[model samples]
Structure formats: C-alpha cells, structure tokens
Target chain A: MRAGAAGLAVWPRWRPVHDNGELKSGETTMAYSEKVVDHYNNPRNVGTLDKNSAEVGTGLVGAPECGDVMRLQIRVNAETQVIEEAKFKTFGCGSAIASSSLATEWIQGRTIDDALSIKNTDIVKELSLPPVKIHCSVLAEDAIRAAIGDWRKKNGAE
Target chain B: MAKRVESAVAAACPGCAAAQEGRALFCAQCGRIQPPPGCDYFTVFGLRPHLNLDAAALEREFHGLSRRLHPDRFIRAGAQEKEWSLADTALVNDAYRTLKDPLRRTEYVLKLSGTWGGPGKEKTPADLLEEVFELNMEVDEARAAKQAGKDERAQRTGLEAARARVAEMVEGLDRELRAQWPAWDAGAEDTRRSAERAMALLVERRRYLSNLVREVDEILGE
Candidate 1:
C-alpha cells in the first residue's frame, strides 16, 4: 500500500478543461452565474509578481479534479504586514477564474493576517458558486493560504 | 465474470422466439436486430469484465458488428427494424470506442466492479501539486519571453523540453498502470482491490500530466 492510499477515495478522476465540451455533449452542463461570467471575461490582477523579491509571496495551487492551475502572489509591507498589492493567474473554468479574481481584489490592502481570515465559503457566497463549483472557491482559498504561508516563511514572521 | 443484472440471452426473440447470443447484435435464429442489451460494455462484446483485453480481436469484432448493424441493411424493412438497427449500431459503436482504449477500458471495468468512484472527489498530492505548479511557472515565463521577442530560441527550447518531460511522465505512468491490470484481472479479492487503487492513482496522475502537455502545445502554437 502506498502512502496516502487511505485517501484514495478522494483523489480526482481527472477531467481536462477541454474535455468539458465532450462531457457536455454526453450530459447537461450547468450555466455559469452572471458574476462568474463577468469575472471570467475581465479578470482582475491577471499577471505575475517578482518571486525573488523579499516583499512578495507566491502561491501556486491546482484542482486535481479539473486540472485547473492557479497562481496567487502577494506583495506585503514588511513592517506593517499589510498586503500592498495582489495578483493572480488561473487556468480553469469560469468559477475558478472568478474565485481567484475575487480573491486578489479582496486581499489587496489588507494585512497578511487579515487576508488569512478569508474563507472559501466567503468566496462561494460572494460569487454565488454552485455546489459543484464550490471546489473552485476552495482552491482559491488554498491559494491565498499558500501565498501567505510562503511569505511568512521568507520573512520568518510568526 | 462481473455480476450481470440482466442478460440478453434471457430474452426470447420477438420475431421467432429463439434464444439470443448474449453479446450478438442480431438474433441468430430469426436474423433480426436485437434490442440494445441492458448489460455492461464488456458483455456487449461477448467478454467478461477484465482489464487485460485483446485489442486486435476487439477491433475485429467491432468491425463485424458495425457492418451487420448498419441502418442501411434495414432500409427495406419496417420502421421498427430500422430503429433497432440504429440503436444497436450506436450501442456497438460506444462499446467499441470505450473498450478499445486502454485507460477507458480499465476505468469501465473498475466502475463495473464498484471500485471506481464517479467525478467530484479530487485531492491532489501536495508534492505533485508543487511540482506541477513549478512547471506551470516555467511555461508561463517561456511564453512571456516569446511574446516580448526576447530570446525566442531559448523560450522555444524551454517549452519543448517541458513538453518532452511531461510526455515521458505520462508514458511512464501508463506503463505502470498496464502492469497493474493482471492483478485486477485474475487475482484474489485483496489483490484486485489493491490493483484498483493503484490504477486509479496512476490514471489520475497521467490525466494531470497529459493536460500539461496539451497546455504546452497551446503555448507553442501547435
């Protein structure tokens, strides 16, 4: 038995984003919310930050289920620990893109600790994400936590 | 053999009241197109639920079934016969396509055995996620460099190298997956369950890597 085999039941079946069309042909697909469409169309802070900079923290996360990849980065003020800037890039469905876009918008200007308080449920509520797409919000939350974790590790801050 | 909830042979032919071949698309006694069997895909091909399949033999069977079940063969017959022909042909096509591919075949069997879960449950290994994310970063950087027209040759090389690496990983994972087939095909219950979990993990990882390769191809304008 391999390590983590106990969690095997939860591992993804793995559907590529491109496969969504083929899946739709087989069965019905739910429509995206208007907010999801808007965010997907014009995502905010879609760019990269300087990873080498001491002030910046980069978090890269993926949804194993849909093969969606997201990278969230934060530039923080060392003394005050306030997030000065935030950016994100997500390669996923509309819900995922919207979740991360909303995440970046929420984290900017907040302290690192304050940003950490943001929850996946908060994202789902804000985006009106369906039950199935709730994982996308979870991915966004994980990305935020990962980014802050990275920043904390670099700054050696508690 | 996998459990059978319903059998094609159990149903008497509507035309001649003759016994049907469990997998046959047509009734042998009356030469009538049979209804699409309520059985699994493997049963549709006259095979047990097993992971290790004979690809060449499957292809031959599929061709034979497709030719006989063609709707054109029933044009002179009544509307019911024509409808049966189309439905049987569709079932055969779907069964053949699903069974011919190695990954799809394994997944089908796994599902039949109640080992494979449907979609929505997905949690990637943290280490693998880290590795995939790092590769994505490199790919993104390469694309940005190409867009800026800075060291286009270097970016092309980097992208090619990344694609090659992902492809190699997929092939390696596939080989490992195929190796597990026999254990599930004929082994005892313990071995079969172990093989199922292993194959599931391998298939999941392969899909993730394959998607990366596709993304790399898109980045390269392929």
Candidate 2:
C-alpha cells in the first residue's frame, strides 16, 4: 500500500469528505464555527435543477494545490430573475464545503444581480475563515460568477 | 521535509577518513554520525530529477536510509547529533513519499526546475470547455428531475455518459504519459529536452484528471 493511504483511512485525512466537511485535526479541533459546521453538516438546497429549463446556471471551480472542487448551481425565476433555488456540492476541506454551502443558502431569494454582490471577503467573514483557508471563500465567490455567467449566456442576457 | 536555502555543506567522519556524502548519518568506517550535510529529496537518494523512477529500487534505498536516519539509534549520541538524526529522518520520510508517487514525482521535479505551481494559466481545450457547459446543464436537469419527483433516468444516463467520456480522455492521456516515461528515463541530453515537453502533458493530465475525479464524484452521487 502507499505510505499515507493507510494512515489516511485510519486517521482523518484528505478525501472521503464527511458530512459538513468534518474537521480532521483532532476530536477537539473545532477550528470552524458552529455556523460553518452547521452549514456544512446540513447544507441547504443540496440538489440540482434542470439546466435545460432556460432558467438554470451552474459553476464548477477547483483549487489545484489543495485539491478542492466546488459546483454551485442556481435556478432563476423567469419572471423575477430572483434565484428561486441554489444548490451546491463541494469536495474540499471543511472551509470550502462550508463556503459553498453557505453561498447556496445566501443566494436563494436573491436576484442574480444581488448574488453578484456577494463577495469572498463576506464569506470569509461570515464563516470566520482563517487566512490560509481564505481561498475556499474565493472559490465560492468564483463559482457564483461562473454559474451566473453561464445562465446569462444561455438566456441571451450576456 | 521542506527544503532550505543554505549553501551546500559537506562534512567528514570524525572517527575515520572516509569522505561523507550529503546528509550521511554514519561514517562508512566507524558507526558514528557523519558530519552535517544538506541535500534535498533528489540528493538524498542520489537521484536525478525525472519521472521514470524505479519504484522498487527507490523503496529499497528509502528503507536503508530510513534505518540509519531513525532517531532511536541516536539516543546515546550528543544532543546535536540526536536533533540532526530526527531532522534527517523527517526529511527522508518526506523524500520517500514524494519520490514514490509518479504524479507527485513529476510535480516535484517540475517544481525543482521552477516550472510547477505557478499562476494557473492553462486555457481549457475548446472541446472540453463546450463539454463542461453541456455537462452543467445535464447536472442541473438531473437535480431538478430528482427534486420534482420526475423521472431522472435520462438525465442520470446523460451524466454517466459524460463521465465515461472524460474518463476515456484521461485514460488516453495516461497512456501517453506511460509511453513517454521510458524515453525520459534514458536521460540523454536530447531526451531530456523532449522530457521537458512531455512534462507539460503531465501537468495538464493531472489537472484534467483532478477535474474528472471531482466530476465523477458529483455525477455518481458524491
């Protein structure tokens, strides 16, 4: 077997992400907030939409160094263009999963324009992300843009 | 362990005249800690920076080096020698890990050559870019169907096909990498230049493979 593979399975390590991206440091290693853990544990709107419905947009982003990937999807109401639903699936550290999970929660009920106003720093602040984990927030913000951009292009609103 | 920026230092065995190599823990003549040495992972095993490594040989050498580097052997030594043993042991462990994995070895070699972990600048291939756009739509459709209590069999099939396509692409690239490995291991000057070009493919292959793994997970229900 590979060197770290055995250790990883026995001890919490990268990959095999638990629900809400459980912290792997230790039993008492709760570096994240309850809110972050809560969002991660029970990410709201964790589903997909009909992208062909002319009302859906999807964004996928990953950090190469950290091996983190996030896919955020949004469905806009045709009449109001407000995000009727937002969903996400993230494969990353706890902070990244939380950031995307929180992103999906916050985007619902907001118009696409309003969603655009969401910032990485806001996510960093909201999740209380450390400086090193700040990239996770950045990925969440970028996923929003990419999803929205895809929606706009398909809807001829670009 | 992390590499340092110190200039190369060579030390000699205090008990014997045998010249100590970089990071040699013991004298060839006397079983004493050799003089302090500095070397990176490649230097630790006296390996050249390349992807086509003999894993069995590397592992064998790693075990041999690890035994000597083990700090337990230094319990009776001076404080500085014990500390050096621990540090060198840590370094050897990290080196063994990095050198053992083909993908990681490629990345490390590129990094040592100042080529890897730069700004993310690769453009998505036009074909794959279009696929990503289409795949997103399919994913949303599958999700929407699943949510609305509608039949998502079609959408699920669509995602499966997309994943298969990406998998096939990655497999092809991996085959190319395997073909290039021996050419690189030859290590002639001309082959080295060609190997550099091959390293570009290795990097791109890793990026695509990483994305494919994530995409597969997303489609196959995480």
Candidate 3:
C-alpha cells in the first residue's frame, strides 16, 4: 500500500501557516489577520482624553446590530495643526478593537489635514480584514473623521 | 446496541481473557474493562450512533463506566493496566460530556467523521447584509438619543423586539437542524451530504445568535 510522492501533496495543501498567528485546532472565529491580533493585544495609547480641552478632539461611534462602540480622540497642536497624540477605546470584537487601535497609531505625528485623508481601505489593507469584519475598518475611518470634525468646530477652523 | 464499525480489527480484553471487537469497551462473553481510543462517544457508551438517543440509558452507562474506571480499583494492577485505566477513564469522561448535550453531540459526530472540517468563511447571507446596514443606523440613533437625554423608552423597546426576533430565528434554525437528524440516523449515502448541509447551517445559526446576544447586551446595559 506504499504510495508515490503525489499522495503526500494533500497533507501539505491544508497547512496555510504554522506557529505564527496560527489558530488552535478547533477555533470558531475566522483566522485573524496577524496585524489585527498585534494591534488588538497590544493596542497603542489606549486611554481617555480631557474632553473639555480645546486641544483635544473626541469621536464616538457605534454600530447598532453589532453593538460595538469605538471612541477615538486626537490632540492637535493649536498653531501647527499637527497631531501631538492620539488614543482610542473600543468595546467590540478583535477586529473592531484593532481597527480603532491602528487608527490612533496612524493619527499620531501627522497633521490634522493629513490625518483626515486616512481612509478605511488603508486600514483594511493594513489589517487584512475579511469581508465580514470590514465594518470594523469603516468604523475606524468614521471615528477619525468625526474626531477631526469636532476639533475643527472647537478651534473655529470650519 | 453498538455494532463495531471495523470488523477486521480485534483486541484482547484487559479485564478478563476474551476477544472483543474493535473500539468496544466491554467483552461480549465477559463484561470487563476494554476501551478503544478514538472510538465515537456513542460507541463508548454501548449505544448506536443516532441523533435521537435514550437519555436515561446514556446516563446509566456513563455512571457505570465511570465507577469501573475509578483509579481506586487500579491500585494493585500492573503499570500497563493502570495506564489503560487512567487513559480510558479520561476518554470516558470526555465522551460522556459530549454525548450528554445534543448540540455538542451533533457537532462532535460531524467533526469525528472529517466530513465538515470547520465553519466555512466569507459566506454572508444576502438577508443579513441588507439588515446589518439599517441595524447599524438604528444603533447610532439610539446612542444619540441617550446622549441628548431624550426619552429612550422607544429605543429600548425596539432593542428588546430585536432580541426576541433573533431568539425566534434561532429556534427556527434549531427545528431545521433537528429535522435533519432523522436523515443522518437513516445512514443513506445521500443523507451524509444532507447532514453536512445541516451542520453548516448550525454554524451559521451560532454566528447569528452570538451577534444578537451582543446587541441585546449593549442595548439593555447587560
């Protein structure tokens, strides 16, 4: 019953990844994009900002059916309009959390105008989000826009 | 009664000197300790692999085997017998746990046969796609109402209604799943494919129910 080398090909085809970001044998959730897991587990600058400060801009967004909420805040320098810091809090799935976390990281060190240009597609590309979790990326994009809008209103820029 | 799936396989009973079928726990001639590894849970308990099972008999067999496999009895046995008892006891416990619950048993049977590996990815239902957009908007409105200190009674009611609707949908999926169980038990070649379809449906149902529970929790402040 010894077979040729072609018989071994079936076993190799199923192993997509090994050890690195590999899911356990019987995980129910989709195979998470590696970057998503990175951002989710080690989210950057996760905290609250002084909402009353003229320098801080806050955006809160939630999806009804998904019941997930994301809060993103950015601190912009008054004169330069450059982002000094960014932080976010997400109460959702791993994808949602990673989306907001990556958003906060991307907003930091960029000018307000530059940050505004950031899109959900960039997040999707960076995170390798599947179709089901695309909304999480969209939520991140919306948060960035909302936060920038709030900042502009407070600073009389818009 | 359990029928051995692999007729060519045979084993010597450990407890009493007798030949037993593959994956059978007790010898037909002498009822003694014999557990075959990787045996299906139903077979472990001397029952046919079927969807509609006798609950009382399952419980009785489970208790009896658990007592037989107790570590206390292996105190004087040799190293091999002791190892066998320990391994078999753990397997017996695991088998009992899976077979006791209908949902777990269904999933276990499917997974054991290697017919369905896991839930398929990226197959969003068209109906869910349409509903998700509106539901997200409603969530946004509810949040805004709460923020503005507006009367939120209506929003809460709507959320409760959504939860009830989801529960009803889950119940429907459960009925659909149960209806297919008889086909699986019939063991026709065509029924195998039907069982695979039913298992896939169960996976989708679980996903939808999980989302509904999350939504209800957020709305109800749970």
Candidate 4:
C-alpha cells in the first residue's frame, strides 16, 4: 500500500468483478481512474518547483479550444534517475484533473525507465476511465514521458 | 439533384404561409421573399439576447439540443428536411462558437441587443479610452510624418513599440483571467462578489484588447 492507495480501498468493496476481470459499478466508476479521481477530487503536490536545484521538467499541453490545458512537472535525482517529486496544474474537466493526478502519483520514486514504461492504458485501466476521457490520462502520461525525455535529452542520459 | 430538391423545399419558405413551388421567386399567397433554408444563430439555439449566462449550463444545453437536432440524426428525412436540418445545425454550431469565446461573446451580445454600430452605446472605459486614443494618435502621426517625408525611422520605432505594448497588455489580461478562474469556480459564497468584480474587469480588458488590435491593424493598413 502506498500513501494514496488507501483511498482505493473503497472501490474494491463497491466494485463487482466481471468476466474480463474489470470492475464495474456505475457511471462514476466507468469514467474515471479511481486514483486519478481521488487526486482530482483531492489533488496532491499541486504547485511549482525551484527550477534551479530541482532538475525540473515541465510540460504544458492540451488545447483550450478543445477545452483542456494541463501542466505537468517532475523533479528527478540527477545521478540516480529516480523521480523525486511530481506536480501538476490543469485547466480542464474532472477526468483531465484525475488523469494528471494519477500520473503524478504513479511516477514518484520510480526510475525514469520505469516511469516511461507506464502506459496511458495502465492509468486508464487502474482507474477504469472511459474512452472519451482516456485522452486526458494519455495526455498526462505523455506529459510525464515528455518531461523525462526532456530531462534525459538535456543530461545526455540517452 | 439533392440541391434542387432542397431548393424546392426552401421555395415553400417555412416562415411564410405561402406555398411556392418550382420556379417561383416570391410567395404567391403572401408575396414574402423566400428566406434561406436555415435558422439564425439565436433562434436555432432557442436563446434570447443575453450577456450574463452560465457558460457550463449553456454548453450542456447545446450538447443536449445537438443530440436531438443535429443533421447526423436526420439523415433518414427526405432531402428537403435533411438539408434544412443540416443548415440549421450549422447555424447552431456557429452560434455556440460565437457565444462560447469571451471576446466573440461580448461582440455578439452587443450585436444582438441592437447596440452595435450605434453612437453613444456607452463610451469605452476610461483606461481603455486613453490607450485607444493614444494608439490611434500615434498611428496618425506616423502616417502624417511618412507622407511629409520626415525621418521614417522614428515613426517605425514608435509603431513597433505601440504594437508590443498592446500585445503585452493582451497577454497580461489573459493571465489575469486564467489566474482568477479557479478561485471563481471554487464556489465560495463569499467569493461571489469578488468573482463578479473580476469577471467585469476581464470583460472590459477583453474589449480593450479587441479595440487595440483593430487600431494596430488599421495602422499597419491590414
């Protein structure tokens, strides 16, 4: 169990296991990642960084014309390539916020390689997010990967 | 052709009681000129002229109405009705787009109220008025100086500076609006007064930016 995993305990009880081994309860259960939703419903690490010391990576993505803007930040250990912190600010709907939150939660403490491998589908499946809202999670996942990619590129960590 | 059938349906002109068939320009019974086969933006969305609207509510309504009235759902209708539906849906889309964006929202709100293109509808705000006047004067001076064959460098420099200032102001206003939005959406009852005040400022700032952009365009002969 992680710092935030306790919140998910509520889901397994209410969720009915199905033939596909997926959880189904209601529309609320259908559209959001439980972790993402929890973070959106209660966001963590919601702020900025000391760009000088933090080996920071920031990603600003999404189109407000399509009606969502998300900013993702990651702080990584320069030598170890471990993600030390993650934060986000999003101008979007619930699913977008949840996706960002879920991504941040998943990335903290993981090595850059591990973080990179965590797919958008993993986040979607973890939270059971619906198709329409999957893009939101994908965007967050992309932002994280982008920030890491940027960090690696800058530091010659290819 | 499908277009011909659509034109024939439109020839009936739904608003008028007249039954005009092929080759008729005016209604035989009412003599009203046949209107194009589409609804106007306002009537299509079923909204009256209004400025202060809940945007989220409006979006919900638009999506809900679209589910019922969009032409995609009307493909089975005969050519005429389908054409009319498509045209009407396009109008609805245009209306939603215009009303959704803050700058366009302000312009359309004024236009719908018959306040556009009139003298003394309300003077632009004092701060905006000063900027507008200053920018206009600078442009005029530049043009005059150019025509009189004075040093063009000074005028060119002045024009660039003026354009940069307007751009910076627009960017600053956008930042202010974005910064204020989350606080406004938090739904604190006590914050309502402050939110309304902020919204007023945002609206005014948007108007000022629009005017400034137009003035700059005029100066550049765009």
Best by TM-score: 1
lDDT by residue (tens digit), candidate 1, A131-150: 77888899899899989999
Say which docking band candidate 4 falls in.
incorrect
- Using DockQ as the measure, name the better of candidate 2 and candidate 3: 2
i-RMSD of all predictions: 9.5, 10.0, 15.9, 21.4
Residue B187 C-alpha lDDT in model 4:
45
Each candidate's lDDT (Cα)? Answer: 0.74, 0.65, 0.67, 0.56
Better of 1 and 2 by lDDT: 1
Angstrom error of the Cα, residue A49, model 3: value is 27
B1-222 per-residue lDDT for model 4 (tens digits): 001113333545555665555333234576433323333344434554344446777787688756766557666767655655555455456667766765555444433444332223332344543444445445545655654667777766776787788778877876676565555445475564475456545655554454455445554552
Candidate number achieving the greatest lDDT relative to the actual structure: 1
Q: Between candidates 1 and 3, name the one with more favorable DockQ.
A: 1
Measured by DockQ, the strongest candidate is 1
lDDT of 1 at A105: 96
DockQ of 4: 0.01
Candidates' DockQ values?
Answer: 0.18, 0.09, 0.04, 0.01
Model 4, stretches more than 4 Å misplaced? Answer: A1-36, B1-222
Local accuracy of candidate 2 as per-residue lDDT tens digits, B120-200 = 544334354344434444554554555455666766676677667767776776677667777766778687667756665
Candidate 4 has an lDDT of 0.56
The residue-by-residue lDDT of candidate 1 on B132-180, one tens digit each, is: 7667667767766676688878889999998998899999998999899
